[model samples]
Target: MHQDFPESRLQQLLPELIAFRRDLHAHPETAFQERRTAAKIAEWLGRLPGMTLRTGVAETGIVATLAADKPGPCLAFRTDMDALPMEDRCGQPHASTHPGVAHACGHDGHVACLLGAATLMAAEPERLAGPVRFLFQPAEEGGGGARVMIEQGALEDPRPVAIFGLHGWPSLPAGTVGLRSGPVMASTDNIDLTVHGRGAHAAYPNRGVDPIVAAAHIVTALQTVVSRHRDPLEPAVVTIGSFHAGTARNIIPDTAELHGTLRTLSEKQRRASRAAIRQVVEQTAAAFGARAELQLEEGYPVNVNDPGIKAYVERVAVEQLGRERVVDGIPVSMGGEDFAYYVQQVPGCFWRLGVAPADGSPGVESLHNACFDFNDEAIGTGVRVHCGVAWSWTRKGQLC
Candidate 1:
């Protein structure tokens, strides 16, 4: 028998949904490396009656779209398939099989929730009045997977007016959701600094221009890029993540390499920080008779939510989950996501699905953690959020 949309059915499907989550978690894959994961997703979606499955959209990515009997708007639900590089410490029965790869960011849960939604939508396609697209996106960890999928026209054909996505938050309790109207996430950029100097014997101090000293100066100066160069009111961050140089303690190395990450909320700040970072590296290296090269790679854009769409989704979330379960004015996450790339193309909103467990669990474990796992109880609420938003937006009454 088909499962009902009522709360009881969502509950009834828990065991199966939990199994899906574990299967994916046990065999986590990294960005652009989700081959088996994609195949399993294709198999799962194929069992649904009305789904038109498309695999290899952007190299190991899958897209299964469900069309309603009655024509209406198109709605998208995305689930990232890649896992982060981390050892498992959760000690769960389904610990990661891949050494150094773990579903620490709750991507396993994200995939399971999307599958759960597909199961419900297929069983009750009549309840769905519009076209629904299930985007099993790959490489969301850092590879700009959404941009690649969109470039291939994942949003084409029906061309959804709004795209919705959810992420697990361990901070908020299981039933509640984290939401916001504007600037929900920060933009990310990576800077690689290369300093060139003359190598010499440790005995000869005057003969060599030490790149390590120059790198040290550059790193220290970078700390002031946001504080000294940018406005205090605007939010920006420049962090030196790694510094590498010298093989031997006795001899000076010829080249020193330093890499850092830059994050900003505003475009102006993003641009300004990039320039300032380059300037600091070059100027510091020049003072020590060495030269510096800087390469700045453009990363995920900032996540800006459409106020109207955000309000509509928030309302549906409250109605289905309860008033207290829906929250607003949540602080923006410093992490970057490819969903920003999609919202950059169309009007959309990305929200938080709280998977936090009570019973005195530790505070939120940031994404990419080795021990982190997504909460399974979030499946029911997540399905309701997507289904309700799609139905509410399609109903004749309004454009919610």
Candidate 2:
């Protein structure tokens, strides 16, 4: 089906792409510490015929550029370089060699696909009518690396008119591409609360205030922030993930600590939820004769897809993988992506590339699971899609 020049060449490079992904899997690095990964990616990009490389961005990010003879708008393709801080349990031959670190999120495959696309594009530079920028960002897991990269000038010099990126999805079958318009992913915010109270013996609750009891009430009341305070139609989540208190069975600690995250699809909802959380925590703790402190950290913004850009990507997907392989109306996710930063600055579309196993296959796992492994077959799918999007925009001077 892929008879075009770059697609044909990209298909031939699947084995190499798989190898590159496995190597990244073996030596996974997390967040801003992708020094080795950055070096290797830079080395590979250096071999691309006309690409000029820039390194040491956002600590360990890389940016490469390629130009075509004809005139057109510059386009950018981005992929994350960091891995998760977790042990690999997949036990594959190329399983992570780094202890307590793994590419559980398929960032390894992302790099491979982008690399494969760059390789194909580099093989025939004349096909592109304008410049192309390859962005290898670090710390996408939670460090907001895209924001850092943008601050460090990833979008300057030859600013991109449009950009595109993808994440692997195990929910869809191997050959499908998932697309959606509007808020595709939620914004993430973190919460840290500490409740202070007088220490008391477990047997003599009347003598001193019990922070544990206050913490329990606080947690129970926090749930109401979503159930009663927020509108049912709006999507928001308030989860108290960690709670710590009490040193021994007989003694109630003077303070209880809580950690959690907030997710919302819109700024208005985010503000409302924050207000509700503070009110519930403080009031519930005060009712228990305790004082509470809450610290909220703002995280990545909600990932919104430009409608026109989303439609353009959909057309490109159909052209690359056929109408049967392209999907629409895929449900939105609560997960957060820092790619929101890039698209917030330029017109961009971020979509999903299916990596699910065929029927009856074992070892299929979701993102961030210790047993998760990037399906090699998805590498070619992603490469084809990336090449298709790039080709469509560069050659035709418009995506759709």
Q: Scored by CA lDDT, what does every candidate get? A: 0.84, 0.90
Candidate 1, residues 1-400: lDDT per residue as tens digits?
A: 1122456766787788899889899999999899999998898899999999889998989877897345777788888999988897778899898898999989888888888888877887877758888899999988899999999988888787778898988778887788999889999999888899999987896899999999999999998998899989878889989999999889998999988899998898899988888888888899989999889999989988889889888888877777877899888888888899888877888999888775547644666666677777777777777767766665552434
Model 2: how far residue 361 lies from native, Å? 3.5
Mind giving the per-residue lDDT tens digits that candidate 2 earns over 302-329? 9999998899989888888899999998
Instruction: Name the best candidate (by lDDT).
Output: 2
The C-alpha RMSD of each candidate to the native structure, in angstroms, is: 2.5, 1.5
Judge candidate 1 against the unseen true structure and give its global Cα lDDT, from 0 to 1. Answer: 0.84
lDDT for 127 in candidate 2 is 67
The TM-score values for the models, in the order shown, are: 0.95, 0.97
